[model samples]
Target: MKPVRFWVGLVLVALGVLGILDATGALETGGLLSGWWPASLVGLGIVAMLSQRRMSIGPAAVTVIGLILLAGTLDLAEGGLWWPALLAVAGFAVLAGLRREHSTRTPLVMFGGATTREQSRHLRHTDVSAIFGGSTLDLRQARIDEGATVDAFALFGGVKVLVPRGWRISLGGLPFMGGLEDKTDSTGDLPADAPVLAVNGTAIFGGVEVTNTPEK
Candidate 1:
């Protein structure tokens, strides 16, 4: 997390505490979320910080800070500390996320992780010359070490595989369409022989394509 993000996170947490106290009639309302809201925000901030990469620091803080600012703004938009501070912190975070997202073309070769609640990523295999999402997908672009491949185990985001015109492939699994696989878009050439690879995950809004079963 950026130094600003970390400090913003800290301040948010403090605000949450104060909000809780205020909701319980211990402190002034000062315009903020109900007491419980801060607790939820604190948890989110912590998670974003932990999972955030160098490029994801700003966006990572968005969910938490955005929400907190929204709360404070709603309460104090007309006046008080929240008016300017809310605009500054929340706006800063948004710009940070946008800038990060806009500049993210470095190509992530390996990405994976997890948490209790939610997570996600947007990977395009078409842009990838090599793929190793746990298994191994290699070629000249891959076999010859021509391109880069991302190897991961438990990724939460959507995967977009971009294959050559006639690249053949196979993965072990019963030919059944279901779950996050989004069968309507699953396509891959599995030669007569291959191993079964089971894939189970949700498609928030994207296509899931499989070349085919791994050759036996």
Candidate 2:
């Protein structure tokens, strides 16, 4: 994937260079290059596809849209066909997003709100993302696995994670114009074999709060 991204990035850079040369009157094919600027979108879509390890519809849709735009710009396709195809692509992207949200065990909230409370006896890793939204994960009833980690990201939003008592909580993250609070209490006089839960990630213009609560 890294190699693929590198090549795609090179192609984008080459296109940018061509555009710059054309703009400066250094290239004889300046008019053609300027008119065919939609090729840059195709390069961007390729970069997006290669950057992700998992299969995602977002990049695929982007690639398709870029191709359509390129065709339209080159007079290979009618302009009327482009808009309907783009609308269809948008519908498919929404469906794919909903499917991913439903299938994943981890919680992800983007531009919306969600509450996640799984009944697993042993909790492992969980991911949370909140952008212009809020999310809450209640794990008081679940047992924390040793060295479990929570990856969270918030931008103009908030996330709250509630863990059971007696679990050791470690906070390690960066906040840029934001805050990360670990309100969990330490279990004094307890043995050193308690499970550890590490919270790590970033918050920008947002907040994350992790609190300790008694088991149900």
Candidate 3:
């Protein structure tokens, strides 16, 4: 199993066990779930860092934010530290973006909605983010001659990626208090040289969906 899926399952099973124990009085959680939930985000961030081919800014940011939130929940830190953390994250993202191809367009939506359609003949990597809003990327008209990667992040919002039907899709990412749904059509019987698209990133308090068809 993929590391992301394994970690997600482990977290869910742990939560289920804890709930059962707490309900039966075999163990007293004492609001542990309510207070320590941010720890899952931390774990997810670490897992993402270790599992992917390269370290991603999204995971690093998630780790830092999770730590801050966890500290605040435990009364070990102030609740107003979000701005500083977010600024740090933005700086990191900018630095990372500088290293990427100039043709790559990083789509970011905040408190609104946006859509991007890629018709590139040599598509490579794509990054899409949504914060308190929605973002969509349509790549059905694009051609992936070689491998490609997609990094998607959604926080309190949603991200939808529509890709062409015959490419091989490898979905990897963590969903914290959120969901990741893959609806891409299978690339059955495709030649070994067929293009491969690897989707990786994080969804916190939101969702990410990849499909070959638009939602009806």
Candidate 4:
């Protein structure tokens, strides 16, 4: 789940608790059809969040439906529907952005300007002449395509690129007690300039690699 989304749910729980207290006449409610309604909605939000923990509710369609239904049930009160709707959208957004598998490949986990992910059981970076890094490859087609637009592409599994030597290669992101970029020659044809760069990250387990890049 998203950090913001989780916190929002927590806020709902707090609101629900207060609502219940008010409904029981122990506290004063602002006259919004008893505190029970708010409490009930909070309960629903909790359920939604919990369900998201194991398996995502998917694609935001269901969440939007629920939010709309909830707003309607609340008699479409003034400025009340926005929060619930936003929560639903945020939850689904996080769900859609996470990786479900531990391994995947496309010959090259290209990460750069318009790096196209060509899907195949054995991915081949025909665009370039060399590979960098010393990681494995050929994973099942994954959900989250780990391509970054401006910065480096992050990796969690591992990467092995076959590129010519002498080319500049930069990568970051390391594993616990593990090395950052272990180099190897998969094709023996390396650029004389050692064109290999491994990008590292602060995270102990995630990493990134760039290879077979033609110098502009």
Best candidate, TM-score: 3
How displaced is residue 22 in candidate 2, in Å? 23
lDDT of 3 at 206: 91
- Cα lDDT computed for each candidate against the true fold: 0.34, 0.66, 0.78, 0.37
Higher-lDDT candidate among 2 and 4? 2
Which has the higher TM-score value, candidate number 1 or candidate number 2? 2
Worst 10 residues of 1 by lDDT: 113-122
Model 4 residue 54 CA deviation in Å: 21
User: Model 4: per-residue lDDT, tens digit, 1-216?
Assistant: 233234445656767887798879897765554323444434433443353333222113333554566576666747777786778677655554452242222122223222334343322121111012223231223121222111121222333333334434454432332334534334565445442333322111334334443225
* True-structure RMSD, every candidate: 13.4, 7.9, 4.8, 15.1
Q: What TM-score goes with each of the models?
A: 0.30, 0.53, 0.64, 0.25
For residues 18-121, could you state the per-residue lDDT of candidate 3 as single tens digits?
99999999998758987898898788767766776444555666677787778777876565666776786777677667746644666777789989898878
**Which number leads on lDDT?**
3
Model 4's lDDT to the true fold?
0.37
Please identify model 3 stretches exceeding 4 Å from their true place.
55-61, 79-87, 101-103, 108-112, 119-121, 129-133, 140-143, 152-158, 163-216
Residue 212 shift from truth in candidate 4, angstroms: 28
Off by over 4 Å in 4: 5-9, 28-59, 75-216
The reply for model 1, stretches above 4 Å from the true place, is: 1-34, 55-79, 87-184, 190-216
